[model samples]
Target: MIVPVILSGGSGSRLWPVSREHYPKQFLNLHKDDASLLQEAARRLDSLDNVAAPTVVCNETHRFMVAEQLHQVGVEHARIILEPCGRNTAPALALAALAACQASASARLLVMPADHVIKDEAAFARAVMQGQALVERGRLVTFGITPYTAHTGYGYIKRGEALGEDGFNVDAFVEKPDAERARAYLENGDYLWNSGIFLLDAKGYLEALAEYAPDILEACDSAYKAREEDADFVRVDDERFARCRSESIDYAVMEHTRSAAVVPVDPGWSDIGAWDALYELKAADDTTSGNALHGDVMLHATRNSLIHSESRLVAAVGVEDLVIVETDDAVLVADRRCAQGTKHIVNELKASGRRECQSHQQVYRPWGHYRTMVLTDSFQVKEIVVKPGAQLSLQMHHHRAEHWVVVEGTAEVTQGEGHGNTGDMKSFLLSEDQSTYIPLGTVHRLKNPGVIPLRLIEVQTGTYLGEDDIVRYSDDYGRG
Candidate 1:
């Protein structure tokens, strides 16, 4: 059976405001009404024959999001490998290949990125089937998108000799070119956009990696062997994986392997690398010529623009080729032509030590999520939701006191002295409209033992209200 390996380890900076370092594009339902790119990626191969559950490789920080999105797609029996740090694609693929081989000796890995969109699902499946045929003959197959435009955003693949009905031996791999060179590539029909999608025999890939990129393969092997299975993630040894060299498969294996092959496909695929890409995607489906609007947005005399509003009404007037994205804490307005360069904004934000670059006003935890509603010098207000049967850690703060108002469902409250020297340990249930207080230095835990999500308003008064103030005595999600 073919095992799908989805790589979801990118800090999508170019699509910022909507895509942050902590919550990137892969997990977002960007079009608003559809499944996220990750969910769609997880379900893309459901129509294929002999397909097993997928294995996802993502950053440790994104484990919960990956699991939650997969669960939303009904992919219950899948592996989620957490990389301690970003080690790039080659190491990620190596770890995935090792895991696949362990599960089934003869497993074939159909590898792809989680943040890609393939509009033509049937066509993509057909390409996968074609790739499987090529892999059967000892070839490492990569998908080369048939280029219709002079797009400098993607690398180019040159097709050489034909191997099968639809597959070809890879002649050369070219980096992203200048506009003139891209136009030349488009005019000449021999080049294709490298899609970074691949199909290879798991054992064969390991052997090739051993031959070509020994350091990466060896490091990944050690890390995989030392891996411990956590509650919902495969935890690798941080130090071991950190020693692995960061490289892409194109550089580490496929580009150097003699058995490299390409299957040309045109399935309306996009990496969604920028806001303009999203604009174009929505524009294709929109009957209007000038605007691609999302959320509660109104556009007037807007020509070739994208306006996205998340929380409030956004009005755009007399704009042309502009991109306006509004979030709770930040707003980005950039020229559509320069949307791809928006990564510079993220770079600047990072240089300035801005929190908006890393996360949104809302933060997600294993239990559920919380949004910062208001903040002052000595107090803050938050809206929190805990999933059914989920609970917070038995924790305490030295500088903060909390007031919680139960808004929905029931909250199971545990308050007491901390660190097992039990004193004033009490437990109670609070339904809607009920309230409670947690004094400073008081050990406490909030749980949702009910069937529905527990929503509450948390108002805090403290000299310091940072998240790092927590001293966790016991945590269900294994955080230290």
Candidate 2:
């Protein structure tokens, strides 16, 4: 049986502001549909036959989001493995393969990144089916995208001999070439864009790793052996996994393996590495001058650009070849030609310790989300939304006091007398327009009991208003 391994470790810094470190592009609705890229990737498995539950490898900080998105898509019993720190594709796949082998000895992994886009599900299904026999026979299979253009952005794969009917033996794995070389490869008709999607026998790949990169294999084996299960999360040993060298699967295994094979297909794939990539999604149909937009956006004579407005109306006039992205707290304006250079901007922001690079103004938690409304040294105000039947941790702040004003639905406030410890819990119901206050160092818990969502305005006054000021004594989402 085939088990999809969804690698979702990328920060997607080129798509920053819209895609932050805390909430990356994989979870965002880049396709302008209700489902995110990760959800779509999971849902795409519905097209494949005899596929078992997928294994998702992601950052530890993004565990809740990954679980929530998969749950939204009804992908239950899926393994969500948490990487304490990114050791790149090689280690990520090793953990996933080990888990798959433990579950079923005859498992084959269909490894794909969570952030990839495929327009034709049928084409993808056909491509995967084409490599089934090859993978079953212990051949490491990779899906090579049919190159339609001389694009210098991606690496190329050269095919050698025909492997059965669906694939060819991988002649060589080449790096991203310059414009002249990319054109040469594109015109050669024997090359394909090296799409990172792969298919391999779980045990077979592990054996190949043990031979090729034994240090990565042993480090991952030690970590996976010491891995612990916590609810939906599989926690790998951090220190051991950290010692594993960071490298891509291409550099670590595929390039060195003699059994590497490629299946060429076109499913309208794009990694969505930058804003221009999103714009190009529709430019082919509109004579290379279409404006791809999301949210509330208006354009007058804007050509070959992308305008994404998250919270407000963004109106652009007479703009050509530009990328305009607007969110609640930040806006990005860039030339479409140089949109990939946003990585440099993100690096600068990280060096300067900017919150915009890490998270959005609206932050997601296990319960729901909170948007920072107003913040200062002495006081901070936030708009908090709790999902129905969800609640905050029963905890207290050491340096801050909070006042919650209910704006929608209902809240059950559990107030404690003193610090964050066992005490007489005084409970009260707060309806719309009702207000409550909890004194400094007082333990408090907020729960949504209504059928609808609970929305409230939280005003806090304190010496330290940072998120770390609160100590979580008890949390339903298992923070404790």
Candidate 3:
């Protein structure tokens, strides 16, 4: 049997604004579909015969988002492993391999990143079948992409003698080459772009890791053994995990293993690392113009440009090879060639302490989302949408008090003390235009009691209105 392991821990700083530290491009509906890249990656593996439910490894901050997205696609029984701190792909895969081995002794693990786009699922599955046969024989396999262009953004793999009818032994792994060297590699026709996907049996991988990176293997083993299961998440021991050095699997194992092999796959694959790559994947018009994402847009004589708008209409005239992205808090306009440099801009923003570099004005919560509409010294206003039957945490703030006015549907407000409240509580029903005040230190909670989405205008007033001021008394979402 094969078990899919998804690594979803990238910050994707290169695709900033839409991709933030709090929410990255992997979770974004970049294809303008309901399913995110992570969802698509997991769902595509469902058709494979004898494939078990995927095990996801991600940063602690993304655990809830990953779980919620998988649940939306009707994917249950997925094991979510949380990393206390990222130790790169080597430790990430080690943790996943350990988990898979515990679940099934002889499981073949297919490791994939959550942020990649594979346009041809059929071709990908066929390649996986070929790799699986080799993996079962204890060969460490890596999928290499047939280069469609002499691109310098990715590393290349040189193929050695053909191992069989399916694949070839890896000759060498090359770093990103210059344009001239990349052209020569394309001309030679034996080099393939390193796709970073790997397939290997759990036990075989552990053995190879122990040989090549014994420190990483030992750290992962200790962390996994000391892990604690909380709800649906497996929290790794931070102290042990922190001792694990950060390194990629390519450098830590694949490059050093004698059993490394490369399987060529021709699927239309892109890391989607930058806006220009996203532009290339879009369906262009006769003039090579495409709008990749949602929001109102108008273009005239715009060719080879990618524009995304989140809140307002963007009109472009005679713009060529440009990227225009608009969000509620920030806007990014750059030449297509400079798309990779957006990471530098994100760094500058971080150094300057800009919030736009970290998250959008609207933030997602377990229950739903809340957007700040206005803010001032004494008061703050927010527009909140609560999913049907969802509830916020039962908490209180020492620095601020909030007034909630229901705009649509009904809300069941637990005021002071009630049956649902752990301590002294009062209950009240609020309808459209009805308002209630949650005084400072007064434990309260908001619940959507209606069938439709519950919208409310929350006005907070106090000396401080930061998000961390809340002291959670009880939470249905298991957040403390």
Candidate 4:
């Protein structure tokens, strides 16, 4: 059986504003109307035969998002492994291989990054079939995209010798080349863009890692051995895994392995590395003016540009070759030619300690989500939504007092003084237009007891209204 291992650890800084550190591009519905990029990755495997439910490797902060998205896409029995920190592709693959090998040592892994776009599912499945044959022969297999352009943004792989009708032994892995060299590579007809997709034997990968990157293999092994299952997630030991050095599979194993092999295929693939790449993917569907407009956007004399508006109308006049992205809290305007420089702006925002670089106004949680509507020195207001049967933690805030006004559905509220006893605790129902107040240091909990989502407005009066002010007694989501 083939175990699909989906790696989703990218921050997607280049797709900033819409794709923040907390909610990255993989979780956004960039291409498909119904599925996000990660969902597309999971669903694409449905075309293949004998593939198991995917083992998703993601950051600890994105565990809930990963699980929820996969569930929405009807992918059941998936193993969602949470990495305490980012250790790049090598360690991520190690964790996946270790977990997969638990069930069968000879399991073949179809490694795919969660954030990629592959438009041709038939071609992808065919390539995987070819890769499966090569992998079964104890060869480490990586897919190489048939280069259509002299694009310097991606690494290149030179084919050494033909292994079979559809495979080649990798001669060398070339770094991103300069313009002149990239043009030469496009003309050479023997190079392929390194696609970062791979098919590998689980035991064979572990053996290769042990030979070339024993430190990484050992660290991942220790962490996997000490892993604990929390709900639908596998939590590896943070300290042990953090000690694993950051490296890509190319550098740590495939670069040095004698069994390295490459399968050349074209599946209309793109990493969506920057806005210009997104424009390129979307440009064909637009008018002859080469404008890709999304949401409420109007353009006059705008040529070869991509404009996206999330909350309000965005209008552009006489602009050419530009990218304009408008979110609730931020807007990014850049020349299309310099779109890759967007990451530098994210870095500057991080260096300046800006929260805009981290999340949007609406933040997601396992229960539901909340959006800050208003804020001031002494007071703040938020719109909170709770999913049916979902509840928040039984907690209290030392620095804030809250008032909740129900807007829709029904709420089962538990509020009291001290530690919520039968006498002190009051269990009550709050319907539409109903309100309640929880004084400072009052341990309280809110739940959606109805069949529909519960929506409410929360008013906070406090000296400090940060999220870290809460002291939780218990949480259903296993959050501390």
Using lDDT as the measure, which candidate wins? 4
RMSD of each: 1.4, 1.4, 2.1, 1.2
Cα error, residue 48 of model 1, in Å, equals 1.1
Which stretches of model 2 miss by more than 4 angstroms?
Answer: 284-289
Q: What is the Å distance of residue 116 in model 4 from its true position?
A: 0.7
TM-score of each: 0.97, 0.97, 0.96, 0.98
Candidate 2 lDDT at 475 equals 91
Clashing pairs in 4: none
- Candidate 1 lDDT at 129 equals 88
| Residue 275 lDDT in candidate 4 | 91
List model 4 lDDT by residue over 235-258, tens digit each.
999999999999999999999999
Q: Per-residue lDDT of 11-111 in model 3, one digit per residue for the tens?
A: 98888889999899989988647789998888878657888988999999889899999998888888999999989999999999999899889989999
Candidate 3 — worst ten consecutive residues by lDDT sum?
285-294
lDDT of 1 at 48: 77
State how far residue 295 of model 1 sits from its true place (Å): 0.6
The superposed Cα distance between candidate 3 and the true structure at residue 124, in angstroms, equals 0.6
Q: Cα lDDT of model 1 overall?
A: 0.91
lDDT, candidate 2, 319-398, per-residue tens:
98888999998899999989989999999999999898998999999999999999999999999999999999988888
How well does candidate 4 score on lDDT at residue 108? 92
- Output the number of the TM-score-best candidate: 4
Q: Across residues 352-469, which tens digit of lDDT does each residue of candidate 1 receive?
A: 9989999999999989999999999899999999999999998889899999999999999999965433467899999999999998988899999999999999999999999899
Clashes per candidate, residues 3 or more apart or on different chains? 0, 0, 6, 0
